[model samples]
Structure formats: C-alpha cells, structure tokens
Target chain A: MENASVPSVDNIRFDGSARTRWRLGFDRVIGWLLPLLFLVAILPILSLVYYVSARALPTLSWTVLTSTSPYRTDALGVPIIGTFEVMLLATLLAVLFGLFGGIATAEFLSDRVAGWVRMSANLLVGTPSIIIGYFGYFTFVLYFGWGLSYIAGVFTLSFFMTPYVFRTADLAFTSVPRHIREAALGSGAKPSQYILKVGTPIAFPQILTGVFLAMAIGVGETAPIVLTTQPGVLVPQTVYSPVTFLTQLIWENFAQSQSSGLQVLAFQAAFLIMVVVIALNIVVRLISSRYRKRLEGLYA
Target chain B: MRWLRWVAALPALAPAAILIGILVALVGATSFTNFGWGFFGFHWDPPTDQWGIMVFLIGSFLTAVPALVFSMLIGIGIAVASATYLPGYLTRILDPFVDLLAGIPSVVYGIWAFVIVAPVFGSVLEPWLVMHVAFIPGFGPPTRTDGLGVLISIFILTLMALPITTLLIRDALRSVPRDLWESGLALGATRWEVVRRVAIPYGRRGIFSAAFLGFGRAFGETVAVAMVLGAATNLPKNVYDTGNTVAAQMFELLDSAIGGTGSPQILAALAEMALVLLGISLVVNVLGRRLIASLYTEQVQGL
Candidate 1:
C-alpha cells in the first residue's frame, strides 16, 4: 500500500475530500437517477390504468357485460362465461398438478431429483409464453386433433400456470418448521396424512399466493388460448367445442380502424381484466393477512 | 410405503417431460423439413422454397437488446428504491402498482402499445427527434414508416419486462446484509454512499442475473411486439422502421402452419424457430438461476 496518504480516508473533513466529493457526486447523481428511472419504468402502467379507465368507464354498461349476439366489440357475454369456466378449470388443473409436483420436491424427492425438478420448473417459467403457445398449437391442436376447442385451450393455458404454482408451493412447503414435521412424523400419521394435515396447512398461505398468481396469469394470458382454441361467440357446449375469450375481445378491437365507440369496448374489456387482476391481488393480501393473524393469534 | 413415495414423485416428472416433449416436437419438425443449416440464412420467402430466419433473429435482437438495456436501468432504480432508499408510503404505492402490472396481460399491453403509445411516438416524438437529433444514428428520420417499429417495440418490451426484472433485482438488493449498510454508514459514509459502495456491490450478481432473465423475457415476448412491430418483414432501416421478430413471425404465420392454408414448410420453420428460442431462453434462465442459487426461497428443511 502506498503510504503517502490514504487517499480515500485522507483529510476526511466536513466538505468531503476529493474521493469523498467524487463519491458524493456519484451519490447525488444516483439519488436523482434511481427515482427518475423508477418513474419512467412505472409510466406505462400508470398511463395504462388512467387512460383505459378514462375510456372504458363511460362506455361500460349492462349490455356490454350481458349481451351475446352482436357485431364486433358489442359485448363480452360469451367471452365472460368462457373465461370464467375455462379459468376455473385451468386453475384447478394447474393447482392440482402444481401441488403434487411441489409436494414431491418439498417432501418426497431426493436432493438431486428435486434439484432437476426445480430447475425445470424455473426454466419453464421463463420459457417464452409464445413458445408455450406454439407448443400448444403443435401438440394439442394438431397432434391430438383437438382443433381449437375448449379442452385444448384449457390444457394450454394451464400449462403456462403450473410452473409458477409449483415454485411457490414448493417454497411454502419446504419452509415449514422442523419441529412441526417431527411432531407430525413421530405420530402414527401416514406419509400422505402427515403432508396433507400438517405440511399443507402450515404452508397454505404462501401456496395461496401462488394460486392467486396463477389466477392472475390465467386471466391475462391470451397466446395459449388463441393458438389452441377458436375465438367464437358461444361458450363451448363440450370440451371439444369452440369458445370465445375476453383478451381476444380486447385484442381484436384495438385496431386503429375500429370506431371510437368500438374502441371503447376494447377498453372496457381491458378495464374488466384489470379489475379481475386487481381483485385477485387484493384478495390474496387480505386472505394472507387474515391467515397469518389467525396463526399468530392462536399459536405464536 | 415405498410405492407411495414413488407415486408421490410422479407429478414431478410432468414439467421435465413437457420440456423434453417440446424439444422432440420441434426437432421432429425441423428434421421433417430437412432445412438443416440452411434454415439460418437471410431470406423468408415461402413461395420459392426460400426459408430463412435471419431477419426475425435480427428483429428480436434489435428490440430485445435495447429493451434489456432500458429496463435494466429502470429496474435498478426501482430495485434500489424499494430495497433500500424509499420511504414506506412510496413503496406502498409502488409495490401494489408493480403487482398490478404483473397481472396486466400481454394482450392488454399489445393494445395499449399499438393504440396509445405508438401514436405518441409517431405524431409527436419522432418528428421532434427528426428535427433536433437527426444526426444521432438511432434518431434518424423514418424510412419505412412512423411509430409501431423497433422503438415502440423496445418501449413496450421495457414496460412488459419491468415487473419481474424489478422484483428479482429488489430481492437481490434487499438481501444485502443490513450490517453492511450500517457499517458503511458508521464509517461516516452517507446513506447514498452506503448504497453506492455497499448495497450495490453486494447485489451485483443478482442484478446481472435479473438482466439475463429480463432479456429472455423481452426476447421471447410475442403479442405486444407483434401488434406493434408493424408485422412487416422489412429489415428495419431505423428505430422507426417496422420489422418482424421470430416470435411475431410465428404468431402471424402459425395459422397457415396447421390449417394447410399455406404450406407445410411454414410449420417446420416455425417449429425450428421455437426450438431456437427455447435454446436461447433456457441458457439465459439457467445462467440467471445459477448466479443466485441462495436467493431463491431460502428455506432450511427440517432435519
């Protein structure tokens, strides 16, 4: 070390030494920079909320929500029903498999096996939604000859969600306290019983967060549905039949050529989607808080 | 009991199987076409049996790289603020906003980007840039058209990629030991200086990982980029020129691929594109995950 003067700490005083001044300058720049960049990052979502609401609010009506047989951008009735039915089905499928898979990783699998499963799930989570959509087109729509039907779309969309559910559920399950696991295992409880009664309840809140996350993804995703299912008016009579979706409604209506009135319907559909997502977020918070409070209030 | 354990592990097989199945499907399709290395050439005309993916690759590069740089900057700001600096109220608002943004599907972003954002860039921003900053390379006058091009796609992708990037980076920066910040500050460093020297350095790998993950995200984004990237195969002349990404190309031509409305060649080509895309994202995400193995749900299993 050069002993002439310790440059960073040398002459440390109120006005800041040269190095300190430089650091302060950088600090000031960053102080301004971080907040400014944050605002820029958020600008889209802010504008999206404000602008879509402004356009969609006045145009929203019972007819838009309830009417089925109409021209382009007329109503969301069929899409609404289809979305609800399909999302419920998709969420069920996603959660069920995600739970089993999560349980395997958290409770049953060897370390190497669990590592592979976790890695695969993480990879799929980042795998492009479009690729998943593309896969859905090939595997479900063509290979299976499902041909743009309800079950195909449900399976496709559900695939997009399972990785998320798995990651979160695995996390929740693994975090259960050691004593609790021992207590459950020491008793005469079967493996399944121990996992179901003790492990799941302990981790349910965190797992619920993933459920809501998948729910939100289910509402927002369009690629899987569009590629794997047909965009038609009526709700599918059977899993084989074609069905419509709200995101499709929003997608088709946003064309520059659509009349302002028609465009309003697109905004309405978007706004409706925002409402559902926001509600899921809020509901998850509420439930998690209540669940935590109950746990702490009773046990802690 | 042994059978029960094996049965319990069965569900873990699904994700790995699906991933391999996708690879197999894409490989089978690529083999069917027999395009081999010829698939990576420049042109994409289907009529004369000229099938190449170079243009869409370039398109994805143009949009996704810039989007990565931009979102990284914004994501760092967000991560730092939420993780360390911002007061409670601001983060309170920010946390929910980001959560809502994550849930706002790509289709909505597609609509908003095309209808709302593209016009502003076209009618207002591009003209001003043309007047004032024409000398700058990326800010030149429009060649093919205005708005709904590489610039708008980049902007939309930045927004689309923000939530996860920010969240990952926030997790990284937040994981910086409180003791480190306190030690820095106790040594007479300001709060900002502590952030500069302590929190950031500690969180560097996580931030880089976030970039890789975010890059994969924006690179593979389809609906928004397709809706706004002008849907034309024109090699983008400038930031304002329309171009097509591989994902967008797949979206546009996928119908013909299956229905036999166009040609069997297109399906094989799209499958190849999907495989290439999968290869790229898997590498990116694996690198990302490997960089911060401890940053995941940090749980200690019961003995």
Candidate 2:
C-alpha cells in the first residue's frame, strides 16, 4: 500500500493561526446564527402576505373585482377601472418615451450625451415615486390647474416609469452585437433603417422585459397616484373625466369611518392589486427564463 | 459622420433635459426670494406663517441613520455567508425570497409593520429588554404603543433596503476573482481568513455603494413611513418616541397645502420638498458616479 503524503502538523507554521482560528470560530457562530437571522428578516414579510390575504381573500370575488363600488356606498367599480385606466395610459406613455430615450442614448448620442442620459436615468430610477407624485401635484394639479384628472396621474406615472424602460431598452440595444450592426450597415441599411429594422427587432424581447418591468412597477404604485389621481369612488363617464381606480377605491374605503359596502369592498381591491403584482412578477420570471433558455439552446 | 452622431445624440438629450429641468425648477424654487434663508431659521409656526425645516430634517436623519446602520450590518453578514458558505440549493431558495421581498410594495410593508411587527415588539422585545437591560438612562419607561416609533420605522425600512443591499454585496463578492481564493487556499489559509482579508477588501467599494443605495431608499421612503410611523411632528426624545420623517411630513402637509391654507405654508412645504430632492439627488449622484468610476477602474486594472 502507498503511503499518503499529508503534511505533518509540526511542519506547518502557526503564524496568524490564532487569528485564523478566532475568525473561523466567529464565522462558525455566525453560520449557526444565520438561519435564525434569515427567519427574523422573513417574518414580517411572510406575516404581511399571510395577514393581508387572510383578511382580503374571503371578501374578494369576481363580482367585487368586476363590478364598481355599490352606489353612494363608497363601493368598488370606479376605483378598479381607474387603476387599469391609469396603468394602461401610463404604460403607453412609458413605452413611447422609453423607446425614444433609449434609442437616443444608445444609438444617436455622443459618449458625453450618453453619459448624461445614463446619469439622469439613474437619478430618476433612484428618486422616490412620492416625489414624482408631489411634482405632478404641484405642476399639473395646482400650477397648471389640471384638477385631479387622469391626465395628471398618467403623466406623473409615465415620467417616473420611463427611466426604467429607458434603462431596459438601452441595455437591450447595447446587448445587440456590434457585428450585427455593422452587417446591417454593410447590407446597405441606413442608420434609421438599421435601428428600426435590425436593432429594435433583435432587442425586442429585452425591450419588452423593460416595459413589463415598468408596467409591473407602475401598476402596484400607490404613492404617485395618492397625490395626483383622485382617491375614492369617482367613475369617469369618459377618459377625459376623473375616475377612481381599484387602488383609490380601496384606500378611500379603508380611510372612511363608516362601514359601508364600498368601504368593506376595499379589502378586495387591495387583494387584487397584490395578486396582480405577484402574477406580473411570475410573468417577468417566465419571460427572462425563457429568453435565457432560448439563448442556451442556440449555443448548445 | 458628425451630423449622424449628433442625430443619435438628440434622443439621449431628452432625458438629460428633463432631469435638468426638474433640477432647475427645484433649485429655482428653493432660491426664490433671496434663496429663502428663512427656511434655515428656527420659526416653525404654521398658523402664524413662520416656517422652519429643522424638525423634519432631524426627523429624516434620525430615522434614516439607524435604519441604514441596522440594515448594513445584517445585509453584509447575509451576503458574506451566501457568497462564501451557503450551499447551492440554499442560495437558489434565498434568491427567490429576496426577489419576493424586493417586489412587494412599500405600502404593504407599512401595513404589515403596523399590524404584525408592532405588537410583537411591544409584547415581546420591549418587555424582555425592560426586564433584563432597560435600566439604562435612554431605555426608561417602555410604553405599549412605542412599537410604532422611530425604532419600528427603522426596522421596517431595514427590511425594505435589505434585498438591494444583499444583491449588491453578493454580486460584489462574486466579482472577486477565483485566483485570490486559490492563492489563499494554497497558502493554507482558512475560508474565513480569506474572506476577511482578501474578499472584503476587494469588495469594499461595491459594498459601500450598496449601502449608499440602501441609505437613499430608506431616506426617500414616504408611504411606508407615513402609514406606520405615528406621524407626530416632534423631535423624538428616545428611539421609541413617535416622530415623522421629512418625506412623511411632506406627504401629510401636501394635501393641506393643496386645500389652500396660506401662501407661506405651501411655499414652505414646496421648499422642503425641493431641499430633500436636491439633497438626495446630490448624494446619489456622487455615490453612483464613484461606484461607476470604481467599477471601470477595476475592469481596466483587471484587463
């Protein structure tokens, strides 16, 4: 049998060994404590979802979700519609602004201009939604006298969400290989044609990912809406008219003292928003994973 | 070629112009009427048309600092453990959980804090602390509803910031080259030593940037703070005393301003918002620039 060549303990130097042992002990202690720490970190989140769902689920139904709040009762329909209307409008605005901004930053601009665009995008991303809400409240609602209209809310959310889309689109465009762009140009494509036909199509999935992310963020957003969009049950007769969405309906219902049917109905709106956010997150995951799988499949 | 480049650049200019406009408006508003030195002076009577932002400033700092510290400690520890010690399956499990936490709205977290965490802290941690170690001067007189104070706000804010901090630090740790680890291992160093001596040093700037991002998130957070924090517009005597942050106070006051109280109060609130927007923008920009520069430098050095 061959003898193993393991180093002898005596031959090993113990310089800084004590410090190492202390560190090892500290790490071991931390390792043991980590699961408990993670549990503590998770407790509030788990309990939140559990408690909100428990309070909201039994009350939530297709009727509550589909129908407006009961009349004079501070009920549901107007608010749900309001939420969707605002989100849809905001999403559209975000896509348009994002596409232009992303294209400009990635393809059209000099490096200095691109750098400035990137910085602004970062600042916008970092800026709180409430601040945007306040800006909307000040500029549109008060200064310009828009008066709590859908235009105010849509503009506010769009401004805030556009940065996200811009980041996504820019990344998407950048991810397209230089070789492809060159090849497109070599094939007699104009710059505009190259961007519109080649660049955008190649980056469509990523651009969609960005838009979806913005939408997901915009849909769940309560702060910006809290300031600009009128809260409570106000059903718009038309897109130009002011209307409360599901979130507003819920907030108003919860804010009131009297336990009217509409007030009771808010629990359902809250649940629906939560469900929508979770579902959107799932969709985001699915899209991303699918994109990754496609890439992997091609390579393999 | 230059004209084409300019054409391309035009699109990028739009966002920059928008951001610059916002900054200009904010600064212009703040600087209107001789730069509004009255904003800095101590005269906070709303009814009498006296305005001071001292309380809100104190409130913001008080809430944000503790939250930043607590979250950084816990987040760094978790990131380190996940990066170095955690098994693959556990890491994957934790990733989704982090994402879930990140995805949940701040308002929902506020509701959760109000409903669940408050009672637990009031019933459990407060009593235990009082019994065992609350004899200290700052720790006197534990109250029941004190759970909804600055401390609880900090706790909730910490949760909000944790996912970002964790993700950033984890990425930072992952960016540390394998050669460093291999060298350490060859030298017969333990994993803990290598992490403490090598990995953390390399990841320090990244970790700092992560913490700064957390600070920004905690500082600017309004809805959650508004919902759960008792919203008493006072300088908190103790960590357990009810208080309001700058953002929360702005939210509470914005509606009133809209309702047409007076010109001074509305202007004062506007000035406050402008100040906060400027402060946060400056800090975030500086930190972000530093982070990007550091990253670029690292990449260059690596190449």
Candidate 3:
C-alpha cells in the first residue's frame, strides 16, 4: 500500500530549498502556538477549581453534605437539600413535558408545525438563562403574586431545560429504525403501543442522555433563579413556600459587605455548586459511555 | 386518517403554543405598552419610571463584537494550523483542552476572568500599551484599576466561543478533499497559498455559520458578563471602562425589582428583554435560513 501510494505524494512538489525550510520552521512555530493558546484559554477554569476547592475542602465534611447547617457560617446542609429539591422537581417536569413534546414533533406534526416547534426550541436554547429568569420574575412574581416561590423556580428551570430534552428525544425517536415502525403498523399494533413498547425501549438510552444533559444544565443554572428564588440563609421548610438554595445563599452572603457569617456561608455554597456541577458531569459521561458501549456490543 | 394524523400532532402543537404564547406575552409587556420602540431612547432611571436601554445595548456590542472578532481570527487560524500542519500527538493533547473549555460553565469563565485576566490586564497590558502605543491616535491614557470589567469580559467571552469556532472550522477544512490540496501543490502553490485560495473559499459558508453562532452566544451571554462587569451601568468611556449589557442589565434590574421598590423600572427592564429577544430572534432566523440554504445548495452541487 505504501508503494502504491508513492505516486500520490509525488504529485505535489516543493521547489525552493531555503524557502521551504523557512516555511517548515514557521509552520512548526505556529503549530506550537495553537496548543499554547488553548492552554491559556483554560487557565481560568483551572484556577476557579483550585480557588473554590482550596477554600471549601477543609470545611467540607460528610456531616456538612448530609446535614443542614444550624449556624450560618459553618454548614451547607440547607443549601444542599434545596439544591437536590430543585433539581428533582425540575428534572421531573422536563422529562414529562419533553418526552411528549419530542414525540409529537418528531412523529406527527405537519411540516409547518414541526418547523415552528424546531424554531422555538432553538430560540429557547439560544436565549440566555437570565432572560428566562426575567420572564419568570415578571410572570410569576409580579403579575401572579407568587413572590419568590419554589413553583416559580421550578417553572423557570424546567422552561430552560425543556429544549434539551426535546432536541435529544426528537433525535432519538427519529433514529428508531423505519422498518420497525412499519412492521409494528403492519402487524396491527396501535400507534400508542408502537410508541410505548417498541419506540421507547430502543430510544431509552438516548432519552437518558437528554435527561442527563437537562439535569446538568439545570443544576448549574444560577441567573434564572436569582430572580425567581428567595436568597435567604436558611432553606425554606417546604417546596411550595419561598425557599433559598445553596447558590442563592452564597449570592446573598457575598453581596453583604459586613456580614462575615453570610460571607463564609456564601463561600461554602459556591463550593457546593461547583461540586454538584462536577458530579453531574461525571454521571453524564458515565451514562453516555455505557450507552455507547452497549450500542457497540449490539452492532458488533 | 387525516383527522387522526392531526390528533397525533396535538401534543407537539401544545408545547409550541405555550412557548409562543409566553414569548408573545414577554414581547407585549416589553414593547407593545409603549408602541414597541421603548428601548431606543436614553432614559434609564430607577427612582422615576423612565427607562431606556441605550447603554446596555452599546455595552453588549462593545464587549461581544471585539471578542467575536478576536476569537474568530485566533480560533480559525488555530483550527487550520492544527488540522493541516500539526503532528498527531499535539492534536490529541489539544483535543481534550478544547473539549474541556467547551464543557466549563460561563460563570466559571467569569470567575477566572476576575481572578486571572483582570490583574494581567491591569499590570501587563496597560503598562506595556502605555509605554509603546499610548501616543497613537485613539489610544488613550492607560488607567488600570480592577480591569476585569469590560476587557476581561471580552476575554472570557472569547474563550467561551473559541472551542466551537475552532471545531467548526476544523471540520470544514477536513472536508476539503486531499485531492484538492494535491492539485494545488501540483500547480506549485505554497501550503498557505493553497489554504488561502482553496480551503478557505470552500469552507466560507461553514465558517460563517460557526462565527454567527459565536456571535449569538456572545450577544446573549449573561452569567459571565454579570460576574465580572462590576455592575457599573455607565456607558463605557473606553475599552477598559466598565459597562453592562442588555442581559446583565436585566439581571440587575430584576434583582432590584424583586426587592420590591421599582415596578415601572422592572417594566422598563422587561422592555430591554423584549429588545434582546427581538434582536436574537432576527439574528437566529437570518442565520438559520442562510445555513439551511447553503446546506441545500451544497447538497445539490455535490449531487
């Protein structure tokens, strides 16, 4: 194969001995510069991890993770609980709404309808999370008089997350083998049966990918909740009532100039949010990798 | 059968309708109350009801446009250099860095800017520019105090955008068949000359799509901008001066509004949101249409 490909390399010719050598040297330098720039670009990320970890790690104990802090400065229990609550509520809403929405768009919508949905999905995905928070604030807080309630926070988060699920589910559903759908219909299986029994199982892994991505995005989201959620030190006793999550607790504390208690708690909250984000990322990677391996096994 | 098909489509239509309804309501709240041109003037006051988004609009442009320009130049150059010139080992090392950059959150970028880039700009770039280039026209006195406000915002935004831009350009260049490069070489063209004439022109549309997407990302960026912007609502006097974008302004306005003082200001901020939504919608539609058209045209040409 090497001998056969000799003609291919011979087709191109470099004439100037000195000029070519200089060009080669220049190209080598440019090549090195590209990687160096990439390293510089990521320095910010490395430093953030380092800064947060250095400050929060000594105080981060199992008790801190498991229990809500009674003192303002020492514990992150309430914020952790609030974080899990918000994530759980948001994920449930996203999965339910996104699954049905995705199916309808993929399978049954007219071209115009699908086009419009696709456009909306892209708009939602593209629009900054801050804008969505503003929308929630206006709609839920001002007009509806819900104030800084969990319902508003969940709604804002779910609104932002829905697009991820919609896109993923739509792709997964579309990827279902055409022959299987046809065969199901040929065998007189009802449309609902085809979707629930045949369509869902095959697309389960991809749907999981969508759910994981939505969870990851939702858990890290702060700007939207800045307006919708109450920024208090103590977590609210109930989800229906106004509640402060870990990030909000941090924001509140950090903003206050003289409140050392709030400052320390805020730092702790920031660290927890980072940890949650990192954990979510790892889970997503594991799930996706496992799914890919399963796919390869089936194909092979 | 037709009726059943329409019934089957109702689930999709419902969510679409909800999304459209919310968008319409937001637009109406922001625009229709004052006949839809509320964001044009310069009257943003918290105490009074008067509001305008002139400064925020300018801030968005100032921060996003420069970052977009810088990232495009650097990212596309890097993509080409890596794909066409680099050794395999270097590419492998660089790939993970790009992926990691893309994966990191925008807020993290903001923190990084505050911690790292701000001091660097204040100490290094400010002094160096003052010594070398300050006397030039348009280059003003170098006052470097807590420089994370605008310049660092731009730096962070550029880093956020770089990964996607580089990846898109790299993919585009890779699709330029090896035969094209060989043919160019056959004509005694230098590697750079071949790339300039052949690869760039072939990948122009893809490059535009990548750049347009980056523009959209930067334009709508909030968390990163908000974190490092110092929340200064002033119009930036220079690149180094602090400012806020439409998104950041919305965040600030909403935070204050939720504290329960200014209802009309909140309305005014909503007006800013409407403007941002309109601007984003227009950009996305235009870019999306162009991208689809080019893709189809490419398909037809290939066929």
Candidate 4:
C-alpha cells in the first residue's frame, strides 16, 4: 500500500479552499451583475426605440406615405423620397470613388502614401459634421453659387461618406490572398482585368457594406443638407433646385410646434428614418460577418 | 497602364484635396483679423463687432468633459462585463444591440433627446437634482422646458459616446494574451482580480487611447448637441442653464452668413471657428496617437 503508484481516491479529491470559495463568490456576484450592467448600458437605445415606436408607429399610414406635403399638413412622401434620392446618389458616388481610391491606395501606392491616405481619412471622419456642413456651404453654396442644389448636397455627402467606403475597400483589397493575385498575374492577365474580374469581385461584399453604411450616414445628415439644400415645399425640379429630407422634416416639425399632432408627425418621421438607418446597419453587419466567416473557412 | 494607377488614385485623393482647400480658404478668410485676444472673448454678436468665442469654448468643454467622464466609467464597466464577466451567450445577444446603438444616426439621437429625454429631465430629473444637490455647480433652478441645457447635452453625448468607448475598451481587454488569464486563475486570482490587476494594466494604453477618442467624439459632435443645447451664447450658470457650443453656434453663423447679413468680418469669424474646431480635433487625435506611441512602438490595433 505504501509503495502503490496510484493515489487513493480521498487523497486526490478536491478541497474547498478559502481562496477558491472567495473566487467562486466573486464570480457569482459578477455573473449576477453583468446582465444588470448591460441593461443600464443599453438604456438609451431601449428608451429611444420605446419612445419612438409607441408614439410614432400609430401615426404612420398609407395616406401619410403616399401624399406630398405641399400644404405642409403632415405628409412625408416627398421628404422620404428625397431622403432616398440623396442617400442613393451620395452612396453611389462614394462607392465609385471608394473602389478606385481603395484599389489605388491598397494596390498601387507605396506604404507611406497609403498610410497618409488612411490618416487623412481618419482625420476627415473625426471632423465635425457641422464643419463639413460649413465647408460645403463655403464651396458649393457661396463660392460656386450652386445655390441650394441637390448636386451640391450629393457632393458634400459623398465627400463625407467616401472615407468609410475607401477604408473598407482598402481593407478588403489588402486582405485578398497573395496567391490569387500572383496566380492571376502569372497567367498573364492584364492588371486592369485582374482588378476588375478578380480583386473587385472578391472584395465586393465588404465594399457594398461600406456603401450601405454611407447611405445610412447620408440619410441621417441634417447639417450639411440644411446648409447646402434650401428648404422647399415642392419636390426638387432640377439638380440645381432646393430639397427637403426626412431628418430636416423631423427637425423643422419639432421646432415649429409643441402640438400633439405635430409631435406625432415628427416622431413618425424620426421612426421612418430610424428604420431605414437601422436596416442599412443590419445589412452591413450581416455582410461583414458573412465575409469574415467565409475568410475563416477558407483559411481553416 | 501605369497612368491608370495614378488616375485611380484621384478619387481617394479628392477628399483630402478638398479638406486642404477648406483649410486654405479658412486661413485666407481669417488672415484679415488681428488674431487678437478679443477673438476669444465672451461675446459673439457680429453686428455689434463683439465676436468673442469664450462662452462657446467653455460650453464645449463643459458639455464634453462630464460626458467623457460618465461614458468612460460606464463604458469600462460594459466592456469588462461583456468581455470578461458575462457568459458567451449573453455577449452574443448584447453585442448587436450595442452596434445598433452605434448605428443610430446623430439626428435620431437629437430627436430622442429633444422630444423624449428633455421633457423627462424637465418634469422629473431636474426638480430632483435641484432639490437634492443644488449646491453643486452643475445643479440649479429648473427652466420650464429644461430640455435645452448642458445637462441634457451631456446625457445625449454620453449615450452617443458609449458604444464606441465600450467597443474600443472591449477590443483592448480582448487583446491581452490568454496565457495571462490562465496564469491568474492558476494562482488563485478571482476573475475580477485578473481583469483589474492584469488585463486593465496590460491594456491601459488602448483604454487611454479609447478615452481620448471618445472625448474627441463628444467634443466635435454636432446636430445632436446643437438640438439639445439651447445654444444661448452665455456662460452656463448651472448645467440646467442653456449654454452655447461652437458646433451649435456654427449653425446660427451659417444662417446669418447665408442671409447676407454677414460682413467679411463675420464670415472670417465663422471661418475662425471652423479652424478652431479643426485644431481641437487635430490636437485630440494627435494626443491619442501620442498616448499609444508612448506606451509602445507597435501599431495600435484599431482606430
């Protein structure tokens, strides 16, 4: 028994040490607290969702969704359409620029130049939205005399959003497998062909996600649009004409009256805008996650 | 074919070019000013030639500092709880909500603050604060609406800043090597102790950088802050008092400027404000980069 190689069961049994007990107690308390903390942290979102939905959901209807607010009586159709128009146009421009710039930054530029590009993008992203608004006013409205035009608004928004798209496209391009590029080049494919056929297709999902995010950003913007696009009741007759947007509707409505009817309409406008923005964000998340998973699968 | 690469680069370069052009124009606009101390004075009435920016400056700091402090404390807690203390399944559910919060537009947050939070503060929160802690500099007599004030701005800014701060800190905490956690557990350290003594210390650089970034975000945020803040151009007597901010005042400036009521001086003053905003953000970013640089020479993982 004394010379046995194997330990006895009792000797090998776990001990409830004081340190272990304290650690367990700590873990238990933390486990209980974690959910509570999360709830507190998420209070703003929950509150916004709750308040916006409860007040606004009832007000949204086919009537409100179909008619223009030429009389300013609470219809949201024109503003909603305008929002989509600006968002789509801005995102399209941003994505096109992003694709070209991202490819150039990632594939053609030197590392130092690429770093500069990234730094500038970060700086632009950090600049206040209002500052961008001011800049847009200074250039398009004042200097160029574009005078409250859709083209001006679109350009301002595209400038604001292109950085995100550029960064995403750059990242996507950078992440493309070296072998694929080498193989394409080795097979004597033209650089342009390789980029258009191989590089862009591989990175399309990420690039698209950036475009969606940019659209969300564009849809939500008030300051730039307010600065560049003069407010009008009618739909814009030309690219040079004034425009109105959903966010501006919300802003103008709330400021105009404390009346319950106006408040409801304002809330409704907010609600609709939120739905679109959140939907775009969800698409971004889904695409990025799917892309990540596919990458992981390929590597694994 | 080589020219094609440079041509492709132009799109990316355009934004940067535009940014530089804005700076150059701003500098040119402001070149006429004496660059005197009066420019930073309290008054901002352009017609009277009283075009100081001190009130807005103070208001900006007042709104941002508290929000930064609040977000940091709450954000650190959230990061710790979600990344280290909480179960994986819980994180899977909560993380998306946080991201959604981040994705909510600044305009929407403004609307929420204006319509929902402002009234709640006016009716419930402000009265309680005045009753309990009126002695504090930030607490004072409540206005009728109580929505357009520094406190409301702080509240909204804190909420707006939370997701970014939390995500950054979470990334920081997660960057710590697994072996450290294993070692801490092996040596009879509690999970909290491991996070407190090891994980936080190890990731302090990232956390500090995150703090600076979050502060920068609050500092430069527009629309939301402008909406909630009443944009009165005065030094705030208390948090409840309506205070002006640079971003908020920029809107007014633009309006007047666009109305053609503004002189070249007024336009230059607006330009100067823009430059100030650009300078502050630049400094904050540089400070953030320097913080990360001083800690380690390795590339900081995320922006």
lDDT of 4 by residue, A1-300 (tens): 011111111222236888666666766686567557677557778899889999888768998987986885778878877877788788888887776787878888788877777677667766778878878877887788898788888888887887777777787788789999999989998878888899988888877876787777778878888778866777778999777788877766755667888788878888898898888888887887788798778865
**What CAPRI-style quality would you assign to candidate 1?**
acceptable
**Can you give the DockQ of every candidate in the order shown?**
0.41, 0.32, 0.32, 0.36
Extract clashing residue pairs from model 4. none
Question: For model 3, how does the per-residue alpha-carbon lDDT over A1-300 read when each residue is reduced to its tens digit?
Answer: 001110122234456598876765554465456556665555656777787677667666887666655554566777777778888888888887888888878888767767777667665666667767777777776677787888789888888888778777777787677888899878999877888999999888878877877776787677878778884456666665766666566555544552655554555566666766667556766666687688668654
Candidates arranged by lDDT, highest first: 1, 4, 2, 3
lDDT of 3 by residue, B160-264 (tens): 777767766666676677788778767766566667899889877778866876777788777778877777767876666678888877766666766766666
* Model 1 per-residue lDDT tens digits across residues B20-121: 877776787665667866688887888878788889999998999989988888777777766655556677666666655666888888878777887888
Candidate 4 chain B, run of 10 with poorest lDDT: B294-303
Model 2 Cα shift for residue B222 (angstroms):
0.3
Best model per lDDT: 1
Candidates' C-alpha lDDT:
0.78, 0.69, 0.68, 0.77
Off by over 4 Å in 3: A1-14, A17-28, A183-188, A258-264, A289-300, B1-7, B35-39, B48-50, B86-93, B115-117, B136-139, B142-144, B174-194, B285-303
Sort the predicted structures by TM-score, highest score first: 1, 4, 2, 3
For model 1 chain B, give the 10-residue run with minimal summed lDDT. B294-303
Native contact recovery (fnat) for each candidate is 0.59, 0.30, 0.28, 0.49
What tens digits encode model 1's per-residue C-alpha lDDT throughout A1-300? 010111132233657478878866765566556666666756777898888788888878898798877364478888899899889899999998887888888888888888888888878888888888878888888788888898988998888888878888888877777778888899888878888899988888888888897888778887777788877767688899888878866665653356876687778888889888878878877776687687678677
lDDT minimum window of 10 residues, candidate 2 chain A: A1-10
Candidate RMSDs in Å, in order, are 5.0, 5.3, 4.7, 5.6
**All candidates' TM-scores?**
0.92, 0.89, 0.87, 0.92
* Colliding pairs, model 1: none
